[model samples]
Target chain A: AQSVTQLDSQVPVFEEAPVELRCNYSSSVSVYLFWYVQYPNQGLQLLLKYLSGSTLVKGINGFEAEFNKSQTSFHLRKPSVHISDTAEYFCAVSERDSSASKIIFGSGTRLSIRP
Target chain B: DAGVTQSPTHLIKTRGQQVTLRCSPKSGHDTVSWYQQALGQGPQFIFQYYEEEERQRGNFPDRFSGHQFPNYSSELNVNALLLGDSALYLCASSLGLAGGGEQYFGPGTRLTVT
Candidate 1:
C-alpha cells in the first residue's frame, strides 16, 4: 500500500512570488507519482506525473515538480504565481506493478494568491 | 474528442434515498474510476471498472457499488445515502487494462444529501 502526505494545508503568496507545496509518500515498492489541481467546484486536472527518467517534471501553467527518491518526496513548485493559479493541489501515488492498483492521495494544499 | 462526461451535474436527495451517478469515458478509453471529493478535501477513490468488471475498490462500504457497460460507460450507485455521502462525484477515464495511466476527468456530479 502507498500513502501520501502533503505537509502544508494552505499556502498564501503574493502575485508574482514563487511558491512550493511539499509532498511526501511512503511505499514499499516503486510507485508512480502524480500532481493534480482542482479549481473551485471542478474535478481534478492532472498537472504532471513522474513515471520514470528525469526527477524534474514540468507541467502546465508553468508549474513543475521534482521527484526526490532519497527523501521520498515530490514537491511542486512555480517560479511565479498569478491570481488565477489559486486552487487546491494534491499529490498522489500508485503502485508501479499492480494493474489494478488504487491511487492514494494527500489531503490537499490550498494555494491562495493575493494580488 | 470529448473528455470524460458525467450526467446530472447536480442533485439533491434526502437521507436513506438511493442515488445513481453516470459517466461516459473518453474516446478509446476502456477503464473508468470513480472518486468522491468532499467540500475541502482531495478526491478519494471509490472503485475502478474495466472490461465490464470491477477491478479495484477503496475502503468504502458496501453501499457504494458500480457498474460498467460494454461501451465503457459507468454508473455509481449509493444505497441508504447519508449526509456524509453528499459530495462531488468524479469520473475519470484512462486507456489501459489498469487505471494507473493518465486519466481524463469529468466536470463531476455534485450530490447533496439533505
Candidate 2:
C-alpha cells in the first residue's frame, strides 16, 4: 500500500514570491509520485509526475518537484508564483507493481497568493 | 483532444434518493476510473472499469456501483445516498495497456445531498 502526506494544510504568500509545498510518501514497493492542482470549483489537473529516471521533474505553470528517495519525499517548488497559482495542491502516489495502480492522494494544501 | 468529460455538472438530491453520474473517456483511451472528493479532502478512488468490466475497486460499499459501455463511457450509481455522500464526483481516463499511471481527469460532477 502507498500513501501520501502533504505537510502543510495552507500556505499564504505574496505574488512573485517563491514557495514550496512539501510531500512525503510511504510505500512497500517502488512507487510513482505525482502533483495535481485544483482551482476553485474545478477538477484536478496534473502538475507533474515522477515515474523513473530523473529525480528532478518539471511541471506546468513553472512548477517543479524533486524526488528524494532516502527521505521518501517528493516536494513541489516554484521560483515565482502568481495570483493564478493560488489553488489547492495534492500529492499522490501509486505502487509500481501493476496490481496496485490506484493512485492514493494526500489531504491537500491550499495555496493562497496575495497581491 | 477533448480530454475526459463528465455530465450533469451539478445535481441536488435528498437523503435516501439515488443518483447516476456519467462520464466519457478521452479519445483513444480505454479505461475509466471513478473518484469521490469530499469537502476539504482529496479525491478518493471509487473504482476503475476496463473493457466494460470492473478491474479495480476501492473501499466503497456495495451501494456504490458502476457500468462501462462498449464505447468506453461509464456510469456511476449511488444508492440510498446520505448527507455525507454529497461531494464532487470525478472521472479519470487512461490507456491501461500502455502502462504508466498517468490518468487524465474530467471537470467533475458536483452532487449535493439535502
Candidate 3:
C-alpha cells in the first residue's frame, strides 16, 4: 500500500513571500508523485508531477517541487506567492507498476495568502 | 477543447435516498475516474471506467455504483446514501488507461445529505 503525508494542515504567508508545503510518502514499490491545487468551490488542478525524471519538477503558477527519494519527500516550493495562490494543495502517489492504478492522497494543506 | 464536465452542480439528498451524478470526459479522453472529497480533505478515489467497463476501484462500498457509456461519458450512482456521503464528487479524465498521465478534473458536484 502507498500513502501520502502532508506535514502542514494550514500555512499562512504574506503576499510575495516564499512558501513550502511539505509532503512525504511511504510505499513498498516505486511510485509516481503529484501535487494538486484546489480553489474554493472547484475541482483539483494538477500542479506538477514526478513520474521518472529529474528530481526537481516545475509546475504551473510558478510552483515547483523536488522529489527526494532518500527522504521520501516531495515538498512544493514557491519563491514568491500571490494572493491568487491561496488554495488547498494535496500530495498524491500512485504505484508505478500498476496500470490505471488508484491514487492515494494526503489530507491536504491549506495555503492562505495575506496582504 | 472543453475540459471534463460534471452535471448537477449541487444536489441535496436525504439520508437513505439515492442519487445519480453524471460526467463527460474531456475531448479525446477515454478514461474516467470518480473521487469523493470531504470538507477540508483530499479527494478519495472511488473508481475508474474505461471502455465502458470498470477497470479499477478503491475502498468504497457496494452502495456506490457506476456506469460508462460508449461515448466515454459516465454516471455514478449511490444507493441508500448516508449522511457521511455528503461531500464533493469530482470527475477526472485522462487519455489512456496507463494511469501515469495527467488527469483533467471537472468542477465537481457538491452532494449534501440531510
Candidate 4:
C-alpha cells in the first residue's frame, strides 16, 4: 500500500512569506501524487497533482510541487502566501492505474498565516 | 450545477447502533468513493463504487458497507457501529478511474458515536 508522510503538523507564516510543506511517499509500484487543501468548514479542494511527464507541476492558488522520484518526495511550495491561503493541506499517493482507486493521505499540515 | 452534496451534515448515534449516510456525486461523475476522516487526521479510503457496484474497497471491516443507485448516488452504512467510527465521513466523486481524472470532495457527514 502507498502511504504519505507530511513532516510538519503546523506551519505559521507571515503574509507574503515563502513556505514549503514537505511530503514523502513509500510505494513499491509506480504511483500518482496529489496535494489537497481543506479550508475550515469546507471539503477538500485539489491544489495540484503529479502523474507523469515533467518533474515540476504548477497548480491553482500559486502553489507548485516538485516530484523527485529518487527521493520519493513531492513537496508543495509557494513563493508568497496570502492570508487567504491559510488552510489544512494534505499530501496523497495512489497506485499507477485503475488497479487501485484508494488514495493514501498524510495526516495533514495546518498552514496559519499571520498578519 | 451543484457540486457533490451529502445528507445529514451532522449526526449523533450510540455505539452498537446502525447508521446510514448518503451522498450525491458531482454532475457527470460516475465513480463515488467514501473516506473516513478523524479529528486532526487525514481522510482514509473506505470504498469506491462504480456502475452501481463496489469496484474497490479499503481496510474497513464488513460492518462498513455501501450501496449505489443508478443515478450514481451512494450510501454508506455502518452496522453495529463502534465509538471508533466517530469521524467525518467524506464522499469524493471522480469522472472515472482515479488515474484518468481528478476527484472532488463533498462537505462530508460528521458522525458522532457515543
Clashing pairs in 1: none
- lDDT, candidate 3, A87-107, per-residue tens: 999999988888785788999
- Which ranges in model 1 have alpha carbons more than 4 Å from their true place? none
lDDT by residue for model 2 (A2-114), tens = 78899999999999999999999998888889999999988899999999999999999999999999999999999999999999999998777675357899999999999
- Model 2, C-alpha of B40: deviation from truth (Å): 0.7
- lDDT tens digits, residues A47-99, model 1? 99999999999999999999999999999999999999999999999888887
Which has the better lDDT: candidate 3, or candidate 4? Answer: 3
Query: How high is the DockQ of candidate 1?
Result: 0.69
Score residue A71 of candidate 1 by CA lDDT.
Answer: 100
| Tens-place lDDT digits, model 1, residues B1-114 | 888999999999999999999999999999999999888877899999989999999989999999999999999999999999999999989887553588888999999999
Cα-lDDT of candidate 2: 0.93
The number of the candidate with the highest TM-score is: 3
Instruction: Give the per-residue lDDT digits (tens) of candidate 2, residues B17-41.
Output: 9999999999998999899999999
* Candidate 2 collision pairs: none
TM-scores of all candidate predictions against the true structure = 0.97, 0.97, 0.98, 0.98
Residue B77 of candidate 2: its Cα lDDT? 100
Q: What is the TM-score of chain A in candidate 2?
A: 0.97
Candidate closest to the true structure, highest lDDT: 3
